[model samples]
Target: MGKPLSGKVTVVTGGSRGLGREMVLAFAEAGADVVIASRKLDACVALAEEVTKKTGQRALPVACNVGEWEQCENLAEAAYEEFGVVDVLVNNAGMSLLYPSLEQVSEAMFDKVMATNLKGPFRLSALIGTRMAAAGGGSIVNISSIEAAHPEPLAVPYAAAKAGLEALSVGLAHTYGPGVRVNTIRCGPFDTDIAKAWPPELRAELARHTALKRIGGPADIVGAALFFASDASAYCTGATLALDGGFR
Candidate 1:
């Protein structure tokens, strides 16, 4: 038998770092050609080179700011132009800047957050998913956040955007399915670059809420990502998988 994702092509936004980076490597190891899209072209190139060197999978690094609708469209066109069809599309790019209070959240800040977290995914998924349905079948994986369901005051805009993303997954599934599967990964705190800035007390408090008693690692997301990207999740669609270590 072939590798699970052998001969497939995948596009992952935010593929330059953190959980996105891990997923890119995992997909390559599973024998898929990957398109790494992020705002930072240099970072994407670096990771793409690493992926090819390590796994011998073809990697295309493209600079894309998912917050922009045109960029999202260009990203899709670029991916299809290079690989013909995208077997898996992961909408992983997002941002949540800390604010002192909801009142302090500027219109610009809120718009930027929403554009990246919600609007970008909606455009990309609609573009690729529509094509997927017409061409035969494919998978669309959205990276949401636990905050979407359990909002924190510091990042209301982000939470709202993520909540919208979750809704998009379900609606897109209904519209594109039979051939396209849309699902979401509602992630919790993970030990990534962002964690380096977290205060010890805050981290400790976060850990206490998880059943596992600790935050997740970047690697922890690879398995679920692979499952969704490959035939392992053949029967699953319009679902949200919580990879939050049982946050309560």
Candidate 2:
């Protein structure tokens, strides 16, 4: 059989590294052209080149900071211009800064987290989803955090923003569906570069919280992302699937 995502055009924000990088590669392997976007143009370009070399699928790299509204618009325009249509949109750009305390968190920091996590998805989904609906249909996969539903004291602003993201996914599904499908993947800790800084003791504690007894790996997310992006989950929408190893 043909590749599941053959002929499809997928856009992934924060596509330079970590989970976003893995998704970008996975989509290309599945036979989809991709748009690699991130704040760092060089990383995006490098990944784009690798994707083309590895998968023979066209990859367009665009420098974009999802925290900025105009940049998000530009990213969409560039993708449409390059690929003509976007079959899958992955809102994966986000950040959670460590603060000494909630009282110590600055306004700028809070806004930055919210803009990247919540507002960016809102704008992108509206921009791409409307076009998808008009043209026929498409899929939007929002990467949320398990903390969105299960908040912790450490990343309060980030948790709130992700919570809002989950809400946006469901709302967009209802608004753009029948033609478009919108869903979310609420993820837990993964063994990505970010976790490299995590203390080993903390990592062990985190593992104990999950049914799997270990944090997820980059490849662990591919199946869930593919299911949502392809026809495998055609009947699903307005749903949130957790890839958190059944964290407690």
Candidate 3:
């Protein structure tokens, strides 16, 4: 059979690093042109060059802070302008800050978390998913966290935002259904750049809690991502798939 994503265009926020980077590379390898977006323009540009060199697929690097409403709108416009159509969008940008205590969590911290994790996705989906519905069909994959379902003290704000993101996915699916698909990937801890700062004991504890006995790796996200982004998931919408290695 032909490549599942051949002739397709995909936009992935946070596409310059970590799990987002993995998905970007995999999509290009699967024969899709890509828009690589992140806060750092240089990183996005570097990865875009690498993508073209390695996969020979077109790559557009866009600098964006998904936390800002105007930036999200600009990103959507840039992607459509360059690619003409976007067949898939992956809302993968997220942030969680370290604060001493819940009482110490300033309004700024909470707002930033909500903006990046929940608000950005909602706006992007509304903008692009509307166009997707009008143009025929598309897929939107939201990257969420296990914390959404199982919140902990250190990440209450982030957890709340992710929970909202999951809810938004369901609503978007209904609002744009028949021509668009929206789904959530509720992820467990992965050994991404952020995990490098985790204490050894904490890492061990996380692994011990998972049925897989280990945290996920960057590449582990590819299978689920491809399935959802391609025609393989044609009938699936308003679904939440746990990609958390059986995190409890």
User: 24-87 in candidate 2: lDDT tens per residue?
Assistant: 9999999999999999999999999999999899999999999888998999999999989999
Off-target runs (Cα >4 Å) in candidate 2 are none
How much is 140 displaced in model 1, in angstroms?
A: 0.2
- Flag the better candidate by lDDT, 1 or 3: 3
Model 2 local distance difference test score: 0.95
Ranking by lDDT: 3, 1, 2
Query: Each prediction's Cα RMSD?
Result: 0.9, 0.7, 0.6
Q: What TM-score does prediction 1 earn? A: 0.98
TM per prediction: 0.98, 0.99, 0.99
In model 3, the runs with Cα more than 4 Å from the true position are none
CA shift of 85, model 2, Å:
0.4
TM-score, cand. 2 vs. native:
0.99
Per-residue alpha-carbon lDDT of model 3 for 1-248, expressed as tens digits? 67899999999999999999999999999999999999999999999999999999999999999999999999999999998999999999999999999999999999999999999999999999999999999999999999999999999999999999999999999999999999999999999999999999999999998999999999999999999999999999999999998999
